[model samples]
Target: MNVLVTGGAGYIGAHVVRVLAQHGHTPIILDDLRSASYERIGDFQHEHVALEDTSKVMAVFQKYQPEAIVHLAGSISVRESVQTPEKYWANNLGAGMSLLLACARFPVRIFLFSSSAAVYGNAVETPIRENAILEPTSPYGSSKLAFEHTLHRSAQALGMCSIALRYFNAAGAHTAWGVGEQHDSEEHLIPKVIRALLTAQPVQVYGNDYPTPDGTCIRDYIHVVDLAEAHVLTLENEYLGNQHNFNVGTGEGYSVLEIISAIATRLSVTPQITFLSRRPGDPPRLIADPSALLSHVGWKPVHSSLQEIVNSAVEWELVRC
Candidate 1:
């Protein structure tokens, strides 16, 4: 199968591309290289073009004639989205609409979107399911939710199948391949902590007085490899519904303090700490109820342990340093 992965040169997308390759599928990468590094994608068939450029996107679709498209391109940072909403709307929602328009022209069978738990906002429920209330607090979340809605409606109209994986806190790395999180402006928690420890800087802990057990925000962290594998499973499952939406997570929650402790234990080094108020739009806790995904695809997260997750991240951090 010919698979086209947008943002294939990115952290999670690169891992997904590699996994698709391992599964005997040829992946043609489409990345703008704005936020991603070309070194990560290596020698994969890459097309350096932005999603907003319809001409370029249409050209790639015409050339590759991909059976499936895993769309991962967009503005991802919640904080950044808040600061620059026009940029977010232009990139996330606008680019999504453009891509869909292009895809509709040269109709691809499958489209796997990289959605987020941020769509759920501050959920009233502990483990958020796909049917939960969606009240996104940030522009980034709203953009993703809007894209999902568009994809859902368009898929039905165009006879295209789509899956939007609402994932949370993608951590860790592919240990065997030496590929891991390598974002430039590194906003995620794990990477920030790793860099802090490496540079002997303070590990800034936001909101140490939350209602959680550790007085900090709690999140459902899933390994990037496991997350990538779920994409592959979505492709293989021909019996999947017309438009499937799954929460790609371990159905487990870990506190910010717990994650820091796990990384500290793995590296055998104490991290410098500094507690502060919670950032705007950050929920107290966001955990996933992956029962629907598990029951549907028999998908079980292999690296559910916090120690293992932190260990993989630490190993990659060492190599990166």
Candidate 2:
């Protein structure tokens, strides 16, 4: 099948692109290379274009005639979203609307969206279920939720189906491939810690005043490989409902300090750390239940242990350094 992967040159998108290729599917990647590095895509068939470009996006659609689209493009930072909400709206919701229109015009079948747990905001419970209220705190999350609605309406109008995977932190690297987490600003907790350790800098823990244990935020961290596998399996699901949404995670919550401890244990070195003030829009805890995805598609996270997550990330950081 010809699959169109937006932002295929990105961190998680690249891994999904590789997984699709391994499954004997032709992945036609489309990326603007603004926030993502092109080299990480690792020699896949790709086009240098943003999804908002109707002319170019349509051109690729006309050429490849893809069976499905895995949309992973747009802004993905809570901190940055709080600072620059315009970028998040323009890139996330605005771009998503354009992409959905194109997909509807092209008459694509399945549309798999890489949603985020941020859509749930600071949930009232620990393990957030799919039925949780859609109350996003940050503009980044709002943008994603906005696109989810756009995808739903577009898919319904076009007689197609879509799946939005509202997973949590996508940590860890593909140990075999070595193309793991690479962030320009390093806002993510795992990669941020790795880079700080690699550079011999004091690890800055943001928002240590949250109401969680150790005064740090708690999150459901999923391995990038496992996250990629869920995307692959989404293609095989026979959903009776056209609007299928699921939470993809290990069903485990780990605090920020817990992750640091795991990393410190894996690397066998004490990290120089400094606790900083909380960033706006950061939830105290965002843990995914992941039961819906598990029961529906039998998708399970294989390498999502905090120890393994930190271990694989350390290896990738070492290799990157």
Which pairs of residues collide in candidate 1?
A: none
Give the candidate number with the greatest TM-score: 1
| Residue range with the least summed lDDT across 10 consecutive positions in model 1 | 260-269
lDDT of prediction 1: 0.88
In order, candidate lDDTs are 0.88, 0.86
Tell me the deviation in Å of residue 147 in model 2. Answer: 0.6
Q: What ranges in model 1 sit over 4 Å off?
A: none
The runs of at least 3 residues in candidate 2 whose Cα sits more than 4 Å from the true structure, single-residue gaps closed, are: none
**Tens digits of lDDT, candidate 1, 1-321:** 999999898889989999999999999999999997768777789999999889999999999999899999888889999999989889888887767888789988889999999899999898898999999999999999998999999989889998999989999997678689988788999988978877788899989888898899999999998899999888877888889889999889998888887777767789889998889888999999998888887788897578778888888888864
| Clash-forming residue pairs, model 2 | none
What TM-score does candidate 1 get on C-alpha atoms?
A: 0.97
RMSD after CA superposition, every candidate? 1.1, 1.4
State how far residue 148 of model 1 sits from its true place (Å): 0.5
